[model samples]
Target: MGERPEGPGQGGAEDGTAWSGRAGAQAFAAVDAATDRLLGYPFVFRELSRRIGAGEVLVDYGCGPGKVADEAARRLGARVLGVDTSPEMLALARGSATAVAEYHLVENGRASGLADGCADAVMCNHVLASLPAEEAVLEVFTEIRRLLRPDAPFVLLSTDPACSGTEYASLRIGDPGEVYGPGDELTVRLRRTDGSWQEARNHAWPVGVLPALLERAGFRDVVQHRPTVEEALTVADAGFATGRAWSAERARPPLVITTALATPAPLT
Candidate 1:
């Protein structure tokens, strides 16, 4: 596939560096995110809608540029909060015409100004790909646990690194038949709205390890779903599902949604 390579730290693995500068933020904002649009986000929203009521709080953890957060607020009528570690991304989000209720900067691995248990649910989409290690992944999950009330759901959306090499409608992960272990580096080529492709260096966290990490982070009832095209037709936005034929996506679904409930507070 024809794609362009972004400059250093544009989408590289570094604290506040991935999607760092104004250029990086804008570039990320322009990502087509076909997998997310077709399968990942729709399933997350549906899971959230079943658990939380309108006006309830939903935190969009790792909300780069706030696109999905804004969409969630509008679609679910929820008070959506967009939180990210990158100030540039937050600045870009604030400048956009978005429905996100609030934007907070993540300082010292904690979301500033958001109270503990403030959200009814939280959805972290594609954020795991940027983490460099399992420890970082655990930290993210632990922070999300802190933001949710007991038993509130935490929904995480990520790509299956094992499905590498296949060119999907919007992105391709690594080379064909390439195998990646946890924390291994991989190249992700993402399509933009302008029909251009750009490459980002991302880490692979195998789907198999997520359940144990969630369990350690004060969560329970962990469940995983690999969304299929047939499922997307029913749950995804009609515009996305019908936009084009998802032949590659239909053959091997690459996205995985892992949901877990925050463990209830201990008895007094």
Candidate 2:
């Protein structure tokens, strides 16, 4: 954690004490509203949902009011759990979600509330970068391994480090850039639904080094897939530039959503 937080902080456009009170609930609801549309949301919920392999349980790590979890449950027919540190965000998630958790995780971004060998898929969309530089990412990976039923797929969506720092900082909140580096203790300034801005320090990590981490975490069948901004829009019923709502909004963002799978290694 000594070095600069890698890359810029990015998120799904949510951040702050969102799970704490009325304000948090409103904040989360706004994020949902943006993604609720066919054009303006972040992440690929439908594609991610369709790809899950007969999942009994799914974990939406850094769930941010649980929109992704709700989408996963609705599409995958899997029992899903959404985890986030904000109470307001949790309430919003609970209202929209049909998952099993009656509560939310208020711990640091790297930790989660679910148990070991529990879920079949873990959707970490726009999540890992919110951790303290590097410490929390590994813990989260370990958590995924422990909660997964072996060879569980970790579907990750994060900002491409190839994207410029200034560009990364431009997203509103819940976007990784806004949540930058967990322990760099870098403060993030975010705008709320009420038209106010708040700041919190976060973590940032690039998309490039993840393969090595997956191998170290005992996940086999680890592979990388880079889908373009155009590809995501076409798949989510959103516009890519001018035609779909999703594509029109996210045409050129550095955001990258990749699907990676890991299986428990066979006994020697």
Candidate 3:
């Protein structure tokens, strides 16, 4: 769900950061829907839903077409707010608005319009890795921290830093002669629903770096979760297994799902 496909046009903030443009946004919306369906509809969101109770406010950071936001509102009965950088994507999200779900534009991860401590929980799915710089990622984390109440949960789903030479149903990484080390840059090729390919750039930070980053952003009790092959096979739709051979051949897990608690503020 975090993957983006480049198209004819690209747009961004005044700083010239590149987000999906009109054409790219349309393609990305389709890709996101297909990817979610193939992966059984935002498994990470479902997992996060299990942890929070009804009526809690959930913020979907970088919510791309509102798929996860819609699901969160429908299934968990939570009031959901989605924030994204792309106006085109935000339009798509708003087009399918639910009574409990709303979206706003966030330029460079600055949600100035949203009041402080407004979210009970925050979910950022694959957004950090899409950023072009580490500073941007940090800024987004700080923004998420700003939005959450003290001790609220911040759930993140992203590509596994330790993964190398892995192939999923719709993704491929670590080609021959490719190197991915700590802080190195890597490219992921994703298959779109239309049987086309889209490339997304990512940074290869070690698995240890994420928790430290979260701590610096005032998040505590960070816990990392990796999916087992059995879990993946089980959670996937029934059609995941077919005439093709079942192979769990991968150097490491393809995705990293982590939960961190926001550190409570000190009393004045």
Sorted on lDDT, best first, the list reads 1, 3, 2
Q: In candidate 1, residue 260 scores what lDDT?
A: 93
| Better candidate by lDDT, 2 or 3 | 3
The number of the candidate with the highest TM-score is 1
Error of 3 at 233 (Å): 4.9
* Stretches of candidate 2 exceeding 4 Å from the true structure: 1-22, 32-55, 99-113, 165-201, 238-252, 263-268
Residue-wise lDDT of candidate 1 within 62-95, one digit each (tens)? Answer: 8877778888899999999988887888888888
Can you write out model 2's per-residue Cα lDDT over 60-127, one digit (the tens) per residue?
Answer: 66666555566667667777776666655666667766664544463653344566667777776655
- Which is the leading candidate under lDDT? 1
- Backbone clashes in model 1, listed as residue pairs: none
Question: What value does the lDDT take at residue 151 in candidate 3?
Answer: 88
User: Model 1 Cα displacement at 128 (Å)?
Assistant: 0.6
